[model samples]
Structure formats: C-alpha cells, structure tokens
Target: MGGEIKQIFEILETNARATPEQISTMTGIPAAEVEKTIKKAEKERTILKYKTAINWSKLGEEQVWALIEVKVVPQRGVGFDAIAERIYRFPEARSVYLVSGTYDLAILVVGKTMQEVALFVAEKLAPLETVQGTVTHFLLKRYKEDGEILEGEEGIKRLPVSP
Candidate 1:
C-alpha cells in the first residue's frame, strides 16, 4: 500500500475500464510499472474484480432490495463467522457483513418483487438455527450507490432577492 500502488488502486476504483497506460499517465508512473503493479494486486486478491455500476431504474426493470438486520447467537468457539458463512452462502444474500450495534449481521438481499424478498426472509432467513431475530427494511429508492449518482447531477439554483 505504498503511495504509487494506492494511487493506482484509487484511479482503477473510479474507472475499472482504465488501461494501465491511462493510469500511468494520471499517476506519473511508467506504464510497465503500472501494469506490473496491477497484475500483482490481482494475484494477491487486492483487486477483486472489475465491475460496472448500473442505474437499473433507467432500464424500467423492477427490482426489490432489502437490508436485513440479524441478531444471531454466536456459536461456542466459532463465534459469528460460522453463522455469517451460512447466511452468505444463499444466492439471495448479495452482501453480508458482521456489524457493530444492535444486530450481529447486516445482509443486503435482492428479489424481483417485494413479496419474493419477504418470502425469502420468512422461509429462508428466519428459520436458521443461529438466527435470533431479524428486522428487514426495504429500499424505496437509491439516489447514490458506490459513489455514483443514479439520478443525473442537478445544477444549483438560488431564488432572487429584491431590496
């Protein structure tokens, strides 16, 4: 995580499609060096995957997303890791995190409809042996995701004042 490597990571994070030559130009590092660094990062799992952020609303495709806060009884010796692994193994659970606060884990899930998500919660998620309780919150809208604005940027406007 030196200066040059960190800079390259930042640049690639913003635009994954950026070529090593483009990153080198912005970072002022040699293209060969940039390529080598990127390759090393990929091998080491520092760079997981190149992804595109899409605003699905524009496509008019209906999708339901929910964040479920789960309280689980940590297994003896194994702790929350085992429960987390079990929860994340489900395809519906897109993202699972061991978080600090009232809940032991927070999971992000997606479905085609609200009922489908609710059924998954009731039939799949809630029945787990380690799960103590769960509170689900559906996402109504997303203005921003992964540092990208879903809606186009709005220009600032000010009301005129008269003396």
Candidate 2:
C-alpha cells in the first residue's frame, strides 16, 4: 500500500463520516482518488464496517455487557475456527476472537438485562460440546470506550507556564 492510501485509511478509521472532499483536503490527495481508494477498500473488505461508538447510557437505555473467556477443544482439522464461528453466530455475541493464555477464545456479549446475559452463558455457551469451560465478567461501568471519554472531563489538564 502507498503512503497516501495508508494516510487515507487512518483518516477514515478516525472519522468514518469524513467526506472524500474533506479527506482530500486533509491528505492533499485528489477527491476522485480518495473516493476511488475508499471504494476499492470497501469492495476488497479491507474496510469491514463503518461503525459509531454509542454511549447508550446517555439515552437512558442501559445495556448489560460481559466478556467471556472460553476454553475450547479444537477440532482436529479446523482447529479453533469452527468453534469460534459457532459461538460468534449468536446474536448476543458482539465480538469474538481466538486468543492465547488460559482461554482459547474471548467473546464480547451484550444483553438487555443481567439475567439475560447470564442465561446465555449457562444455556447456550457452556453446554456446547467443544466448550470446556467459560468465565464471564460483567462490565459494571464504562469510563471510556473506543478511545472516547464517557464521563468526567474530556480535556487535558496542563500546568501553568512560568514566565
């Protein structure tokens, strides 16, 4: 990838809402080139999804979130991919990844209520044949998410300059 393309990707990652013209202004690339690059990236699945980070608490809608650490038995041929796919297919699964250390997979799940999330783990997750064990940690509070401050101060504190 060219330097300009990488810059374009960075700009888009930071703010997906940025227009091609805006990116062109920021990157010094022509708008047409910027548009073409973005389109190609989308087609190639380099840019999977344009997402918005939402603080649902601000809207008085509280959601229960949990991180589940799963120990799984990998199938002989497919390894952990098959198990990971089955787990990720559930609607409650927000993100799923194959990780190292004690757990084979890490799953981020969201639910309307605490019980709902708990039920999902006990009923659907733990019972899977490949799933050896699972440990779930409920998110009590979110101070920051997706690199944005959710509460308290948004600006940095700086010491006064001595003249």
Best by TM-score: 2
My TM-score estimates for the predictions, one after another, are 0.91, 0.92
**Lowest-scoring 10 consecutive residues by lDDT in candidate 1?**
154-163
Provide the RMSD of all predictions against the true structure, rounded to 1 decimal: 4.5, 2.5
Instruction: Give me the runs in candidate 2 sitting further than 4 Å from their true place.
Output: 156-163
Candidate with the greatest lDDT versus the true structure: 2
- Separately for all candidates shown, the number of backbone clashes (residues 3 or more apart, or on different chains) is 0, 0
CA-RMSD of model 2: 2.5
Backbone clash total, candidate 1: 0
Q: lDDT by residue for model 1 over 1-163, one digit each (tens)? A: 6887799999999889999999988989999999999999899999999999887777999999999999999999999999999999999999999999988999999999999999999998999998999999999988888777788777667667757
